[model samples]
Target: MTTVTSRPASAASMAWAGRASGVWLRLSVTAALLAAAGNIYALSDLEGIYGRETSAFVNQAIAQDAVDLAVVSPAIAVLAFLARRGSLRAYLTWLGAVAFMTYNYVIYTLSVHVGPLFLVWVAVLGLSAFSLIGGLAALDGQAVAARFDRAPRRPAGWLLVIVAALFTMLWLKDIVPATLAGRLPQSVSELALPSSPVHVLDLSFFLPAAFISGALLLRGRPWAYTTAPGLLAFLALTGLPIMVTPFVAQTRGDEPAWAVLPPIVGIVIACLAVLAGLMRPLPRATGTPVKVPVSRTDRRHPPHQDAAA
Candidate 1:
C-alpha cells in the first residue's frame, strides 16, 4: 500500500471545489424545495393528477415522494450547505445526493404521467444533472486517493459487491422467467406500466457500476478511493425509499412487500457502517494538494517517455 502523509492544506485546489459548487448549491435548494412542495401536495391527490395511475403505482409514488420530502430533500440541502465550506466528504455526499435526484426524476419525467408535477420534475432533473457534472469537475481524484490511504477498503468493497450481486439476482429472478415465458413480468403488471424502468436501470446501469466499483476497490485502485464514497451514499440513500415503499403500500390498502424489508435494512446498516469507516480519515474541510513521499513506482517513467528516451 502507498502510505500517504498529510501536509499543509492547498488553498488553491480545495477552494475551487467550494466556489464552483456555490451557484449550483443555491439552485439546488430551490429545486429541492420545489420537490418537497410537490411531495407534500401529491399525497392530497392534487387536481386529480394521479387519476390515471394504477393504485399500486400511485402508492409507490407516494412512498417515494414521502422519502424524498422527508429524507432526501433535506439531506441534500444540508450536504450542499456543508460542502460550501469546502469539505471533500460533504462535497462528495452532496454529489451523490444530486445523482440520486437525477436518477429519480428520470423515472418521474419519463414513466409517470402526472402533468402538474411534470415541469417540477424536469427542473429537478436538469439542475441535478448539471450539478453532478459540475461537482465531478471540481473533484481532485489524486488528492482523494491520498486521503484514503489507511481507510477500510476491503469491507466497503465487499459490501458493494454483495449489494450488487443480491440486486442482480433479485432483478433477474423476475426478468429471466418473464423472458422465458414471453410475457410481461409481474413487477410491471402490478404497477400497470408497460415495462419496469427500475429493472432496466438496475440491470443496465447501476448494478454494473456497483460491481465495477467494488472490483476496482478490491485491487487497491486509486480511482476507487474517489468513486466508492459517492456510490456508498447512493446505496444508502436508495435503501430508504425501498424500505418505506412497502409500508406506504400497506397504508394505502395495497400489498406490502414485507419480505423485502429485512434484507434491505440489513444492507443499509452494513453500507452505512462501512461507509463511515471509509470516510473517517477524510477531512471535514478539503483544500489541499496532497504530497505523498515518492517511491520506486512513483519514479517510474511513463511508457511514452521511456520510448522517447
Candidate 2:
C-alpha cells in the first residue's frame, strides 16, 4: 500500500508560528486575568447603558463573569498549552480563543457604560484583535489542513452554517420588526440600550464568517481547513455561555425559562456537533510513504514517516 507523508514546514513558517503562538499566549492570559478581575471586583449600582433596570444588568453581568471564568479561561489555557506543544489542533483552538476574546471584549466595552473596567475591556479588545490577525497570518493553511482528516470537513462546515443561520434567524426575528417599525427592539428597550450588541456583532461579523467558512469547507477549499476549526471553536465556546446565560437569568427571576429553553437546546446540540467534527482524526494520505522529522526536538531521532492525505 502506497502512503504519503508531510514534509516539515519551512523555517520561516515555523518561526512565524512560534511568534504568533507566543503573542496569543501572552495576550490571552492577560485578557483573561483582567476580565476576571474587572468583572468580579467592579460591582456597583450604575445606570444601564441602554435603559434596562440596573439590577437586571448587574445580575446578567455577574452570571456572564462566571461564564468567562469557568468556561473561557479554561479553554484559552488548554489551547495555549496545545499551541506551545506544536499541535495543529492547539493552533486552531487558539484562533477560536482569540476570536472569542475579541468578540467578548467588544461587547463589554459597548455594553458596560459606567465602570472602571471600561479601559480594561478596551485593552483586551485591542490585544485580542491583534493576536487574531497575527495568528491567522502565521498559519500555513495547507500544512494545517494536511494534519487533519478530510472526512469531517463537510459535516463541520454544514454545522457552522446551521449555527450561523440560527443566529441570523434569532437576531433578525427581533431586529427586522424593530427596523420595519422604525423603533428600537423590545429587548433593546427593556435593557434601556440604544441597540443590541449581540444583534450588531452577529449580523456584522460572526454570522458572515461562519457562513463563508462553512461554504468554503464544503467546496473543499484549502483555506476552509484553516478557517473552519477556529470558527467552530469560537462558536462552541461562545455558544455555550449564550445558551446557559438565559437559564441563569431565568433562575434569578429575570426572564422566563421557557422563552430561552428551546434556543439553548438547539445551540447546545449544534456546538456538540461542531466539536465532534473537529476532533475527527486524520486519515493516511495515498502515495509512496516518506519519513520526516516532526520537529527540532525530534531531529536526533530517525525521521517518523506517516501517511496523511
Candidate 3:
C-alpha cells in the first residue's frame, strides 16, 4: 500500500499568490480608469451639444455621467488602497462591488442617452469586471505554479502584452493619417471633433505601461509589484475620455473620423474579456501516491519491522 503526503505552502509561493491579488486590483483600476478617461472626451462637449442655452435639459442629461464617475473612481481607488500584501479576495471583492456599482450606473447612464439597444454594452462591462474579480479571488498561486513547475505553459503576462499591442495598433491607425496630413488631419475636420495630439500621445503611453506592468506581475519582481498602481494610473488617464463623454453622439455630422471610437470601445471590451479568461485558475492534477487499505497488523508491523522479527 502507498501513502499520500501533503506539502506545506511555501513563502515564495505565498508571495506569488499575494502579487496576483495586487495585479488584479491594479487591473481593475486600469479598466475603471479607461472608462473614466473615455468619459472625459464624451463629457467635454456636453455643454456644447446640449447647449448652454438649454442648460436645464442638458445638465439633467449629463448628470448620470457624473454619477458613473462617482461610482467607478472610488471603487478603483479602494481596490488600490487594499492592494497590500496578503489581501487578495477582499480587495478583489471590494473592487468588484465598485465595478458592479459603476455598471449599474452605466445602465442608468446609457439608458438616459442612447436607449435599450446599448444595454448590451453595459451588461458586457459588468460581466467582464465580475469575471476579473472572480479570477483574482479564485487564484491559488502555490497550486498554480506547483502544477506547472515542471510542465511548460503559456505565460499569463502575454495577455497584457497582446492587449497593449492591439491598442498600439489602433492608436497608430487612428493617429498616423492625421499626423502625416498635419493640421489635426482630415478625420478631425470630417468628424468636426476636438482633439489634441497630446491626448493621443497620452493614450499611446498605456500600451507600453500596461505591458510592462503585467510583465512585472508575471516575473514576480519587486518593482513590478510596487509600480503597478502607477501603470494603472496611466491606463486610466488614457482610457477615461472614451467612456464618459458624449463624443460619439456629438461626432455625427462634422466628425465622421471620430466615429472610430465605437469600434475601438468594442475592441477594448473584447480584449478585457480575453484577459480575464486567461487569468482564470486552470484545474491541475498533481501526481501523488494513491493510498490503499491495509490491515491493522500490516500497519502495526511495517515491512522492515516484519523482516527484523
Candidate 4:
C-alpha cells in the first residue's frame, strides 16, 4: 500500500492565513463604531421615520436599525477580534460582515430619505464596499481551505445553494409579475420607496455569490472552502434581524403580526439551523502524508548520507 502523508503548510501560508491587513482592521473598527453609533441614534432620537406618517418600509427600516444596534454592531466587533488573530475563518467572517453591512447600508442610503444619519450611512456604504474588496483580495483561497477539515464542506455547500435558489425564486416571483404587468411591486407602494433595494442588491450580488459558492462547494472545489462558510455566516447573522423586523413592527402596531410573523419565523428557524451546522468545528486535516521519493543511496544510509557526503 502507498503511504499518503499530509504536506505541511509553509510559514508564508500560515502567516498569510493569520495576518489581516492593517487597512482592513482599521476600516473594520471605524465601520463598527459608526454603525453602532448610527443605529443607536436611529433607535432613540430618530422619530421622523417612526411616527404615524411613516410608511411600512420606514417602520421596517427602523426595526432593522434596532437589530443593527443590538446585533450587527456587536458582530462587527467580533469580526474585528477574529481578524486580529489572523484567523482564516475570522477573515472570511469579516468578509461576510462587510457584505452584510454593505447590503444594509445600501438600503439605508438609497431607500431612506436623507436625514441626520445620511452621511454616516453613506460613509458606511463606501467603507463597506472598499473593505469587502480589500478583504477578498487579501485572502488566499487555498490557504483558507487548508485550515478546515473535510466534514462540513458538503452540508455547507448544499445550504448555500438552497439559500441562493430560494431567495432567487422569492425575488424573481415578485419581480417578474410586476414587469409583465408594468406595475410596481406592492412593497414599493407600502414602503413608499423608489424601488426595492433588497431585490436589487440580492439579485446583483448576494444571491449570485451564494449560488456560485454553493456550486463550487458541491463540486469539491477549493474556492468553496474559502467562500461558503463566510457567506453562510453572513446570511445567518444579517438574516436574524430581517426575520425579527416584521415581529418588531407588529409589536409597535405598524403592521399586523400575521402578515410578517409566520413566514419569517420559518425563515428564522432555517437560518438558525444552518448557522448551527456551520458553526460546528471543522477539525484540521491530520496525518495526510505526501510521498517523497528516496533515492537508492539515500535509502541505504538515510541518516548518515548527508554527513558522509
RMSD of 1: 8.6
Stronger candidate by TM-score (1 vs 2): 1
Q: Which candidate has the highest TM-score of all?
A: 1
Assess candidate 2 and give its lDDT: 0.66
Mind giving the per-residue lDDT tens digits that candidate 2 earns over 54-105? Answer: 5456556656677777777667777666665555566677788778888888
Query: Which stretches of candidate 2 lie above 4 Å from their native place?
Result: 1-19, 42-56, 283-309
Model 3 lDDT vs. the true structure? 0.43
lDDT of 4: 0.66
Off by over 4 Å in 1: 1-19, 282-309
159-241 per-residue lDDT for model 4 (tens digits): 77887898899889988899799988776657766678888888998899999998887776656766776787677766666
What's the lDDT for all of these models?
0.73, 0.66, 0.43, 0.66
**What is the TM-score (0 to 1) of candidate 2?**
0.81
For all candidates, the clash counts are: 1, 9, 25, 7
Per-model TM-score, in order, reads: 0.85, 0.81, 0.39, 0.82
